[model samples]
Target: MNKLLKYLLATILAVSFINCTDNFEDINTDPNGISNQSLTQMNNHIGGSFTPMFLNVFNVTPAWNYQLQQGLLGDVYSGYMTPPTPFAGNVNNMTYALVDGWNGFPWSDAYGSVMPFVLDIKNAVELGNDPSGDKFVYLANIIKVSAMHRVSDIYGPIRYTKFDDFTTTGEYDSQETAYNAFFNDLGAAIDGLKSFESDSQFVPFDMSSLGGDIAMWRKYANSLRLRLAMRVVNVNPTLAKTQGEKSLSSDAGLLETQDMYINTGFAHPITVISGSWGDVRMGAEMESILEGFGDGREEKYFNPASDPALNGVFKGIRMGIEIEAKGQYGNHSSIGSVIDGETMQWMTAAEVHFLMAEAALRGWSGAGNVKAHYEAGIRTSFSQHSVSGVDAYLLDNTSTPKDFVDAINPINNIAYPSDVKIAYNNTGTNEEQLEQIITQKWIAMFPDGQEAWSEFRRTGYPRIYPVMINNSGGTIDTNIQIRRINFVSNEINTNSTNVNTAISYLNGPDNGGTRLWWDIPGSNF
Candidate 1:
């Protein structure tokens, strides 16, 4: 009986040990840390994080963020759209008065919405030692370059390259250094993605119109590489040629037919322009250039002015106005429905073709010639807008940009700056040809005012209107106009030490008067 009692006790202890061993992992596991299973659920963490980054870059849902992110700044500065309402007692961005409160949106929105999500996937993929880690890391790198370039373009220097390290996280890279990093990042992405051409994991996670095809993304990246290469041609021609030729020579190809558009799952921000808000309207530049060319796309781009005094003509407001309320210029031509679609354009083939055209002019390899590339760009834009008679429009060498006529306030009207014709003139000087190319490119890139503003700063082609009132307090030159926005107050307040150090990177003051690294103040020729 003693032997039987010992055997029963041993059996009970063995059962108890088995139960503890079986439940150990479940009991010890923290619910907070993401499980490997959860990481693998959404195409290896790419879908969950990438979607928000892509969507919020444009900030489609909240109209006010878009207002500060673009409409009041780039749109106004680029000569694309101008707000009718004069907020802050009419002393605001439109009047060359930089609003610190409004100026912080682009930086805040980017760091808050876009970069965090990108960093998450980057960290996760690196830590997991996932077999597809290179593929995920490379793709995120492309998005990072694309998104951050805009930010750098906005404020000149930005928190890139060292953004991941908490110790040096707030350190800013000068625009030149940031651009070099961008090129390197893009190069890695192209090489890494080429190996994963058949990887179907990206398909479910894509928010772009390319349908998650790795090859398409590669092509888009190549096109983007060309765009960035062309951006630096004035400042760094050798680097520009090297990168441009690399993209031009790639079998992955450029954005030949399709424009890069992200479906934001929300309406385009232009709805705020044409809809009930009625805050924004066509710019004087748009009215003059479109009407001057007799371009058929004008009607598609804007409505006739509602001011009965103007007799239903397509009128536009000047950049700066001291209106008591929006009602003053609210009846001017609002933006058209073409920009009100679900997808937001990142880049277009028309703009790319013009880049190639400029490249050809610079004698870059693989860009056929100036004339062919120029005409192709115009034709592509015509087709994209569903406007016919491209042949006739291209033949019109007599039509120069018309002198702007402000029907409401004739004081704002100005004469055309250039006699540049529509036809591609091989006999013309290099400067003449460049102006023609950039002007058409500017028109093709309508409503994407941010890129247009950057191009305007770089090339100084397609002369934009000066602000009616110079409220910049002698900081911004009225003739030179606003070059780049001052680094936002958020950076000044939260990251004061780093922000102070960054001001040393600027060629001028840390104000709108300063030019960016790529925007060398001179003729491209």
Candidate 2:
């Protein structure tokens, strides 16, 4: 009986071992590489990819890179267009449609990517998954404010408050309402971040090389707060001052470390659509500004004058802004009329410092020196960014308009004589302040030049040169220039009511000529 029992036990053990081997945790219920969940993983991908296309940093899906196209025309900045020649058609071609197209540019953006970044921040905070949740909240507010700033500037008022509800039913919010919400969101973010003290204990998924850090996020948030305050130009000066104070105070936020900047790498350009210069050229206004500052970034930004295109017939008609004018060096298609998206340039350190200086000048209670911030802004532009050859530029200090004239023959060697006035006045008037801020901001934002046009529209400084060809309808008021962009066909068909409601707030029809409700002079005075 004992021998029989032992043999039975052994058999049972053998059976159990066989069963364990058969069940070896190889559950095919789910698979690797491909997963049911994609939106979460791809949200940052979309944000990082699409956001820079408008700014000319990198190119993704090339079908709808029109934001950069219209952005240049609206601001009168040169962009990536072929042949590098000026336009002859009416303004309706570029102004009404091209500029207006940017108004609804965000339409084609993948909801899966943009929505999750904003939503997950709120979700993770509520779920209590990480200590940096408040930082996420801060980022959420920054993202909303920055996105809205762009959308409103381009299209006019947009869906706010209920913006996150687009998954169910998105509602368009008024400019006033949007501004109020923008202010509230930033205010709350500021408060939350101030009280946030705990470091996220979990190992961060190695964004170190990418320059993602908490302190940097806070700094970028504060800089955004300052930018938003400037938008309340026509609403209430007292409120603007109050917000400005909040942005500049010791309690004011900033992306302190260099690690916080959005770094550009050779590994991948966030928004390069085409790899050749056939798509872009240097704008005259940008050339004027950089030459004025004796900026050293001209070599990388500009093409040489001896190219076959710019010499014989086309002298003043190069595309791309903040870079020098040049004809194609070697049939470079990427250097066309639009900003090159394949090029890798992101937010600059000079931008952060410039924002800090602007905040300090606004009388915020921070430890930074306002003047030093301005100087640092210039220094970084020469030192860190890809623009090479500075010593020669500074020796010239200011270049006159005639200095840019290219020779008329082939082998057209373009040696520009110095002729620009660099001493910008700080104490002239409110308009003066706005120009100084925007001009520096413009200098800081190269490669990604969409913001330059946006800033030009927002404040109307650097009175731009009208197209040599009178293509635009007389609607772009000589004084005010292009005001708002027309609503796109996509929005009219999909969100008609909201689009109409938003349109009504615009002083004119939703076309490019209308001044947004916030742009008119209530507090802009």
Candidate 3:
């Protein structure tokens, strides 16, 4: 962490020096620069730094950055959306070739845009010696956990817990250590925010849909705690149960009424990728479940195909297939108007209901009826999208996912793997109910592929199709699929010693096939 921080600071200084003339006074006196005194006038330094952390969590700029951050990896792997373009001549992330060049964006975006701003807020509060500023620190920590958890989930070990300590070398926390830190940080944030529930200081600088409401922020934090709690249930059930009960009983409560969306004043990246560039389209798994169930949300999520051969049906491309050109599947469904707005959704109330449903299935205290929660998840998702016919949709026990048929290439088609139905079966086994909870959660989450991909790897629910092509040179298994992405090249190149130590923390070799700490290989029970 120290080395990376020094390198970033040095680069900034180098760029500033390059633009300077011979006059030191002229170079030092930039009229447009905001002074430290001015920053302290209204805590601009603390509040302004939060915007980047919010935006970079999903990255709403340049569009391609978001494409690499999650669209290319989780969006495809979660069976949500797949790119029509066969980048690198068909040797790319979809086929398990694992492009090092594109895979570094998630890592770099966090360290560059998120971590630095967090450190700035902490430093500003501490340097001012203002105990009243603790509210700002608490808010910053909540945002930090929200951002860094995604980074850790993607690459397993990341530079967290000791990021501010410049004395230590660039050491990385193993995924387990990082998760424990995430839990502790979230717990502390939830507690510290209770007194500031009425504080209105955050409103002017609030960029999220919460609108600087401290009460809502605390609720979001509690909901996030439950999410992280459920993520570790498979590997450490006792700890998971403890944390899950804590979040459920907390007075802060979870996100129950509305979704958490970051108002990143840019067009949704899906619009650019699927609508403008034609690089992305619906996934085969999405087609199977949505179309087969006759779900009303399908019309809100995607448009019918434009190709005359398919006759304007909602179609998608199978991942890891042989495609010589994009034109073959370019006419497949594009993203619909649901995400045409300026905000990027982070977490939803529907997701929290599904989480509660899973917690109840695990028999955690304070987790109410499982069937009720499951049904509420479906209703909440339909309500969020303003879709009708959820009553009929939830009762349909007969419809299962349909087999996928690639209209462009017949060889890429595959059968739907699971027979899981739409209706919740109370008499079914625990595993069966768990699958029902997760599969509905998957559909309710819609375009958030990062969390969806993580859930799929953790629970093995909502059976997705395996890749038709394997280009990993045996580093990845076709059946096991890609478990985790390898560490990026930037870390290996700049921080070789620490990156090597981080690789040893993984369960297997640091490749796409290696499982993270929470991705256990056995039954859900």
Candidate 4:
């Protein structure tokens, strides 16, 4: 085992089996002193194996790891924040030039930290004597789907569906195949969990906001099923509708009043934005949209700029700018305390409402009409952030995205892309209704820019600004923006044949310009 796998095994032995369990620590003692026969009775490690899988997907501490895994990639591409640091002489990912070193973290973290642990849980459950272990198998599958979907979204294909087999573990699955596997995994997880709805074994190990309520986990699984279903709506409408309706009609419920968040022991990673690193500032789209609408959540989401020229105004950096130094845009508005809590938002009630709204627009059965779901989404978002004046905000239909004026660089200023309003546009066409649903969903799912970026690619709503710098050197079109990042060089170095096979699955060359399987290249309607 290499260092990462070694670290994982050590962590499982030290923390997962002992600290994460209810009373495994008190019972298991003197492993070295015990004879071989005594060790066979300790099946406690099986239950504890899930702790690392639950936590590593989001990654709690040593925040810089998360900076590489998500903050620098998804968050930036989602038009949430832009880095001021001119890393590698401004030819890094912020400028559309792929950073091989930086891009490896998201992949390595998933395969190394999440996948191996999930494999362990599955293997241990299969070997265990207790039939109740089936519940844990279901739970592990849910975690696997949650973690791996993000990985599959980032790269067009991934080493899923065959990860358990040594001979085929290195092979890749196309995005469509991966998504189908996800639906199947989540479907089986939900059905298996139903029999264990009253089982309390999960409560001791669950660190999410759901508190190990099996019914609520069922709900989250169903909601995630809905999310994945919508992801492929444009490419695979029949499958999308089939899976989506199953979720909507299920009595297991959805994440309506409650939000899904992970309770990591440390502070949220947004501290890396506002703190000494000063690496990230608000994105130009955020400044334009939030300031234009006079959205009250602006105060909740970001702090005013430190630049005296802007006079404490909310400013944001446009992505892919030619920066000589960090000081150029470092003083712009930093992300605020909204993400400083113990938990980070995964899925929210507001987002679910918006998903339903889109489903309604598509004429899906269980989702209500476009108007009600759209308005409910906004209201739920306002309530989630504890921002008031929603009634007035919702009534005002004239507000639209304002032009973004960069505080430091006037050359970077640009006009807003769309005039889509805040109020529900019932008279609008299906495309217009979709724009309304996805745009609000984007705002409500703040800070978790991975999902936001994915939805933006799918819908192209709330038009995002294109890159100011095209360091991709013709591999990526600056106007089209980056569609998906190329496979990290680490895979090429370690698993060259598999990586080559994966590239063959791409619609185009293995570059940022290539669209994934689900990202249809037309109007959403």
What order do candidates take by lDDT, descending?
3, 4, 1, 2
Q: 1 or 2, which is superior by TM-score?
A: 1
TM-score of 3: 0.94
Residues 367-403 of candidate 4 have per-residue lDDT tens digits of 8877888888899999988999999988989998899
Question: Model 4: residues >4 Å from true position, as ranges?
Answer: 1-11, 14-43
Estimate every model's Cα lDDT from 0 to 1: 0.82, 0.48, 0.88, 0.83
Q: Pull out the clashing pairs in model 1.
A: none
Pairs of residues clashing in candidate 3 = 1-170
Runs of candidate 2 exceeding 4 Å displacement: 1-103, 110-112, 120-138, 166-168, 194-210, 250-252, 256-277, 305-346, 359-370, 386-420, 423-437, 470-474, 518-525
Better of 2 and 3 by lDDT: 3
lDDT string, candidate 1, 259-334, tens digits: 8888666678778656768888998888888888998888878988888887888888778755777777889898
**Candidates 3 and 4 compared by TM-score, better number:** 3
Give candidate 2's error at residue 252 in angstroms: 5.7
**Model 2 local distance difference test score:** 0.48
Please rank every candidate by TM-score, starting with the best.
3, 4, 1, 2
The alpha-carbon lDDT assigned to residue 199 of candidate 1 equals 88
After best superposition, candidate 2 residue 403: deviation in angstroms? 7.0
Clashes in candidate 1: how many? Answer: 0
